[model samples]
Target: MAVAWYRARLVESRPQTPTARTLVLRAPGWPGHLPGQHVDVRLTADDGYQAVRSYSLAAPTDGDRIELGVQSVPDGEVSPYLAEDLPAGAEVEVRGPLGNWFVWRPGGTDPVLLVAGGAGIVPLTAMVRARGEAGSPAPFHLLYSVRGPDSLWYRDHLAEDTPGLDVRIVYTRTAPPGTSRPPGRVTAADIPGVPAGRVYVCGPTDFVEAVDDLLIDLGRDPATIRTERFG
Candidate 1:
């Protein structure tokens, strides 16, 4: 059976970085989604041409509201519109609350580790928010890698010293003044020494593969790791 596409109206939009935007949409009758799921957004042009793209859910639903984090892809058909041009009250067709394997549910007592690269942080951010919303006692550690400070997302919230959550940021190209780690790709040193009960890795294909290998080398059980990757 085909998943139904519902009309979603843009409620608000906020900038995460110069090229990334967070969109809040009000989709009436939207079934709530898991933290790591995504939705497909369909845009129709005046000439009857349509384009669709999938975006990670930035947070769990709030009643009829759902959120997505979009990083603009230069010269792309879909992302540029979502990241820069879409305006409030504009209606688009949305399909999902999709994917199950990547999801993180609330009841576990063990620590959770999250690894995100660039826009991959979108879904992981949702997991973090869900953890807080559910009041789950699971400790979470987030290791996020980006090109530089200018590209970071959820800056304000991540900067906070939230109890039971540890947030680490890695800059691949430029580092802020006095940052201990030099600007470079994430290395084994960036990964936690302690093993987490459940590990989630999301990022570019290369980044995810590198992190998975590093985790395996550090004696983390392959069975305990879950990964989601994108270009």
Candidate 2:
């Protein structure tokens, strides 16, 4: 079946960091998407030049609306605009609800282990919100890795004490004052040993691969881990 493109209007835009932002789009007639699916956003210039990029959905679809979190690539074409200058009411074409293996459906009590590196938090955020929306009793533990405190996304929301969800932030570049964890990459110690249920890992290629290796070393079944690597 062919997935048709829908013209979506930007409903809101909010910055997550100096180089990243979250976008809310209202696409009429949108087929609601599952958590962790992504969409291709098409942007056209006045001269007929078109650029497309895939962004993970940041939240579960809400009626005619959807959300995405974009991290600007230093010299990329589409991200800078979406992350910095795109305005509300501007229209763009969206095609998808893409990728099946990475999705987390509602209504499961199995524990979920989410490992995110940098902007990889986007889709995992959707899973977290989906769990809440569906009233799922799934236990969730998120291990998020970032450069430092300033680059962390969902700072306030993750800080909130939510039942059944545990979040740990690992700073690779700079650790906050008086913290016991040192500034370094994710070590075996950062990952839980042998996740009993599904384990989702998303990040840059290197980060995902490293975490996947660590998970395997920790006695986790490799088949139980699903990874999505970007960049």
For each candidate in turn, give its C-alpha RMSD to the true structure in angstroms: 1.0, 0.9
List the candidates' TM-scores in order: 0.97, 0.98
The 10-residue segment of model 2 with minimum total lDDT is 187-196
Clashes of each: 0, 0
In angstroms, give how far residue 141 of model 2 lies from its true place.
0.6
Candidate 2 residue-wise lDDT, 98-176, digit = tens: 9999999998899999999999999999999999888899999999999998899988778878899999899999988
Compose the digit string of candidate 1's lDDT tens values, residues 1-231.
Answer: 678799999999999999999999999999798899999999999999999999999997688899999989988999999888898899999999789999999888789999999999999999999998888889999999999999999998798778899999999999999999999998899987655598999988999999999999988999999999987
Tell how far residue 73 is off in model 1, in angstroms.
0.3
Candidate 2's TM-score = 0.98
Model 2 RMSD in Å is: 0.9
Error of 1 at 119 (Å): 0.7
